[model samples]
Target: MDLHMNGGIGEASYASNSGLQRMGIMKTKGVIEQAVSDLCRNNVNFPKTLVMADLGCSSGPNTLLVGSMVINAVTNTSLEMGLKSPEVQINLNDLPTNDFNTIFIALQELQGNTTNGKMRDVHHQPSCYFTELDEVNKGNIYLSSTSPESVSRAYLEQFQKDFLGFLRCRSEELMAGGRMVLTLAGRTTDDPRVEESNRLWGPFALALQDMVFEGLVEEEKFDSFNLPQFTPSPTEIMNLVKMEGSFTIDHLEIFDVNWEAWKIMKNDNDASKMKEADDGVGHGVAKAIRAGIESLVANHFGEAILDDVFMRYGKCITDKRSNKENQSLVSITVSLTRKCDI
Candidate 1:
């Protein structure tokens, strides 16, 4: 279902600083190092410095946190190899719709704390640039985007195409053997448990069905309950890479994040536990559902169904624990590098 969230991530209510911090995803240093190392391997004229770009950088917090981690990782790795620290350049790339005010505010906060120990006596501080795709050019060091919206097929296809185009642009801009690291949400090659995929929304849907049976929601409006699957699996990503023949699959791995922390506390059985899974897996769906319900209640059902449905979903998801056999939310991060022709 289509959602109606007035304010998105930038809104104070949706993605607060503290919420993101607590998620333990701010540390992207390891991934960055892997991408760079793969790029520099077997290179004849290795760059003494690196330039990095992060696409869809909603705000500086995400980029700053990732940059700091990358810097630290590079320093540690160089020290272990007994080599001098590498110079670094970082860029924050995002759409014009981004909250530049918050991003600038965050960047200002991180600027003073930047350390450039890699360059000798020459303050090797990393230079940061912010620009949109139209302005970005060739030879950037890195690029990243973690956007989660994949509603329409057209939008999804465009997203895939734009990603490839950006990488091609970055590859040209990069020096010989330069690397670009990208992380995005992905689906599994065969989703080991396909049945459990949609299980997350069972309870919520059932609850809504109950409401529909009670005449709280119209049957025609119920048609908005469509869910689209967009997370491309690691294999699919590899295929895209092969098809494009631009970037190489240097370091490709996928792992799951347990965002079900709050879900287990709410649901206790498989049916109810499914709702917990929905909270994480069907996030977009849940958002759509909530938006649909909110719109209906506000327009037709009155305010009564709002609290009624919300409390039902919340209580079921929060109070019940998973059946111990069900699959919950699993976030996959794919890391790739630019491949050079021999």
Candidate 2:
């Protein structure tokens, strides 16, 4: 199935609710700047034409966040170096279901603006899976501590297959010395039992599980769903690159932050904060999470149950995190330089 974030600028749309994503993009600016600087000074001449791509560029206000940052990086670096800015070709891509229109419309106003010349032209595309689960794993939307060992193994196998294919394609697309940077939510270690990945997906899984119990969503419908997310450790990626032999790791870093820290209400001391905000953490998270997965959930279970489903979901989030102040969200960033075609 083609899965995408809910589109448009409405309250429930990703454009309005993607603050978490914007935060991540903010964190990556330094790394992106460094990459741009390296690309400029390390070369004999600042390459006249530069190619950039955002592989999973989801639509919204933040859709071009990374691309714009890169453009700025190049422009700043060129000015600092007393060199001319290169003509930049940016390729923004996502699933076919993604709302590309949102991005195109935003770029319309900035197309001929005073930033370094930026172009949009993409010439290619690429494409993965998990199936079958034991009775114990039924109705669970993602890997959990209770998930059978085979469940994790299946996910690992699939991710390995998919990621290796990703390396192969990119190796071919990039020049021998060209650079690529990847930042994703992944585990600190190879263990599937790791709590961080579980915490990240926990709320959504819980929301859907409760729906199954309340008969809002059929048990079979819930059972058949699994997010094909495998949180690979840095070592796992390093090993994959070594096996693929197309890229050498230039940089690898891990960052940890409180999960959805932005939405956490400020005060439990007064006891009025949550009440005044009408449960800010829960209500805010429901909107944010729903913005991301509304299309998927509605595609699977029709759109009519949305309001009731989110009401319960908000309560679930409040119940779990009302007291717990911190939940870990791990992000791994890796930089690689293409070395071979395959």
Candidate 3:
């Protein structure tokens, strides 16, 4: 799925439906804070003008939230050390089709006087894929426990190329000793198809299979659909960083969050109502997944079945939750520093 093209202000737009992603970002705030803190502390030649980029920074509140957090961290650290606060240059990057207008508007609202020097400049890069992959794997690469080894191998190869290329580009841009903090959905196990990794997609895929059975979507279409996502393990990420040879991993951590944890918390953390909340949690997770993947699914299965497909998926997730069979989603956060030039 072209995540940039698919997200905007529409009902299925990522901006309207990315609460789950925001929660993941929130979970990693401490890591981000520490990374910024370390950057200020360790770099004696810290730039008087700081340049920071948020990669894959999809639109909406989360985009600005990250920038603000980073800025706050740097500001606080500089104050603590009696250093001058640097002029910050924030670059929010995603795909060419991302709803940048929304981001710009939000920025204007947040910073009324751009000339006041709080933010120096905002540059948009229209084309930013660090590595390219074939679209042929579109519908055929579901990584379930029963998935073939060949599928897993192909996914890993693609990931390695993409990650290495990303690191190379960033290494060139970042000054020596600059720091970066990244957070993404990831797996705790090397095995990609384990329940923790595929908890959401497995049920969603089964929902599609049901549609094929009922003639709602063509079996051929179902057979060709593969999600354009990879959740790498910590070892894989470390290996890529070492192989790329441009950056050093300073810190890495993996954390588990229940699919329904955010939803439950939103409802005031009422443990006494656990039974009633189970179904809600299932539907909430299903909705989040739908917002993320609906664009790709609609592109393949026809937009006509969008609602029906999610309904089935929601029920499937609900059943799993009610049976206490669902697993928490795992997230990984990494802090890295550009290797000093020899």
lDDT of each: 0.47, 0.72, 0.73
Worst 10 residues of 3 by lDDT: 266-275
Each prediction's TM-score versus the true structure: 0.59, 0.87, 0.87
TM-score of 3: 0.87
Score candidate 1 by TM-score against the native.
0.59
lDDT (Cα) of model 2: 0.72
Report the error of model 2 at residue 183, Å: 1.0
The C-alpha local distance difference test score for the whole of candidate 3 amounts to: 0.73
Q: What is the lDDT, from 0 to 100, of the residue 309 in candidate 3?
A: 86
Instruction: Decide which is better by lDDT, 1 or 3.
Output: 3
User: Which residue runs does candidate 2 get wrong by more than 4 Å?
Assistant: 108-136, 260-279, 323-325, 340-342
lDDT of 1 by residue, 78-195 (tens): 6666777677766766544344555555555444444553322211222222222222211111111211222233334544675567566766766545666666545454542243
User: Which regions of candidate 3 are displaced past 4 Å?
Assistant: 5-11, 112-117, 128-141, 261-279, 323-325
Could you say which candidate leads in lDDT? 3
The worst-scoring run of ten residues by lDDT in candidate 2 lies at: 266-275
Q: Residue by residue across 1-342, what tens digits does model 3's lDDT show?
A: 454434556755666556566667777778888988888888768558878998877776667777777777778888888988878888877778677887887785435322232776887776554323344333333677776676777778878888888889899999888888888789988888777777778778878888878888887777667766789999999999999998988899988766655343321223233324444666777766776666667777888998898888888887777656555788899999998962
**Candidate 2, residues 1-342: lDDT per residue as tens digits?**
647888877778877766566656666668888877887888875699899888987777566667677888888988998988888888877777777777778775344433754565643242312244454466467887777788788888878888998898888888877889998878876687666677646666788788778877888887777775778899899999999999988888888744454442211212123223444567777787788877777777788878877877777777777557445567788888887455
Could you arrange the candidates by TM-score from highest to lowest?
A: 3, 2, 1
